[model samples]
Target: MEREESNNNNKQHFSHKHILTRLQLDEVEEITCNACECDVEEEQFYGCTDCKYFLHEECAEAPRSIEHRSHPSHPLTLHAAATYSNQSFICDACGYVGYGFCYSCAHCSFDLHLFCSTLPHTIPKEEEHPHEIQLVCEQEKLLTSDMISICSFCDAMNTECWIYYCETCNFGFHLNCMISKVVEEEEEEEEE
Candidate 1:
């Protein structure tokens, strides 16, 4: 049952082809995160045999800095994992528990999703929404303490989840929410 559950979880996490491919292991490649203990497949998350720069796939995609579409005023920069004063971060993506790799606007103290920070400046119209997304910076003065926007993909308020949006067409979606939804749908189909 344990093996069965593990197989099921792997299927739920990644497409069969993605997960089934044999891992490319090398003696030179160093193990990065022991906490997650996830294996490397085609492309490594972040690593170099010579230097010590390494991160999880989740971490590599994390925004060192970004301009969010919804809260465009100032650029959201990635802050190293640290304890926050009053507000703490919780990634709606992957449901990982930690307090680093957060997106913040130095000008307005705006918080955001790390995955949202990694969103492509221009999204494919064929994916879901039919529009090109350009990064938008929020002006410090215009930003309110509260976030007021809805995710076009999940149809949820964009409070904790940051988003990608096309201003001309008004198309928007949460970065991680969209990925999760697709993965969930695939798993549901497999179960059926």
Candidate 2:
């Protein structure tokens, strides 16, 4: 059985070919979003029951283009896939490879993962530091050595992933590490 629900303020009408509906999950299912190719493991999602197209609630509601703080020079546009190839894209925010949706700048070839595009501009200062951690896009020309830089949290070499840096402390964090930290902090606050 199926049910139709009214579109909320967040939902945008993409096309008439697909009638998107909100889906309620009763149990865990391995459903992937058609837009970002990420797992729809959340309790609710928007989907096209007829075409089997699905999107995470956030992805479905994301603006067509946004002026991200990280890349202030130009606005990033949300795209189903890379314009040039069907191949995976390297996320400029996290530095990881992704096959799904991306927020990209056509002029600079800069791309960020759909979720990464939503990361906050700054993070609260950790106990070890006195200043707020700022999310930055490292410049390729700034690399003085061919060696990889180690992430302060994961202790992994940052060969291609995005990084969080503190200029005063000369400290750096992997984008994934920062994302996890933010999530953990939010969860902790929710519990209190």
Candidate 3:
């Protein structure tokens, strides 16, 4: 476990056969993290520049397994990437295709992206929705409509992912949409 602060050239990560060196990107290219299979969004990450193998810092630190609320019957094990014959998986939480680090239950075929696995069970009521929103996962159906429904927050349709929903308000949005935005307050009142 090499600390990011050290900037040592021989960081030992379990994912790769070669030693990863710390790197900072001044101008990022079309690089993707081998671990998460997502575009390299971080300016600083560990990489084997020679192999073009990279990992987002968070991905490098992910636990090997976790007890997730979504799949309560069994603990999900983390894999560096999809191990299915197809080498791909549809994230149960986001309803999107993924080819990177994922938490899965092999018996149930349930899969979740490393990022999606961390979403809170509930996002408290907000002024925009006026009611508490709870994360829902089950048979693929949106409660808002019998037919496909567009996300209230994002213009996309419910594409078979878990959602933050408010049945009373008949409101729902994808986990990606809810998380991509700044949903938390940023300021506090200052009394002089």
For each candidate, give its TM-score against the true structure: 0.44, 0.70, 0.73
> Candidate 3, after superposition: displacement of residue 19 in Å?
1.7
Model 3 lDDT-worst window of ten: 183-192
Q: What lDDT does the true structure give each of the candidates?
A: 0.47, 0.72, 0.75
lDDT of 3 by residue, 82-191 (tens): 87999899888877788888899988999999888987778887676678887776544555446435677787776576777777766778776765554332122222
Residue 122 in model 3: lDDT: 80
The backbone clash count of each candidate, in order, is 8, 2, 0
Answer with 2 or 3, whichever has the higher TM-score.
Answer: 3
Candidate 2 matches the true fold with a TM-score of 0.70
Leading candidate by lDDT? 3
Candidate 1 yields a Cα-based lDDT of 0.47
lDDT agreement of model 2 with the native: 0.72
* Model number with the top TM-score: 3
lDDT of 3: 0.75
lDDT (10s digit) by residue, model 2, range 2-96: 53454542344462256677876546457788766766778778877677777888788778899876678899998877675666788877767
Ranking by lDDT: 3, 2, 1
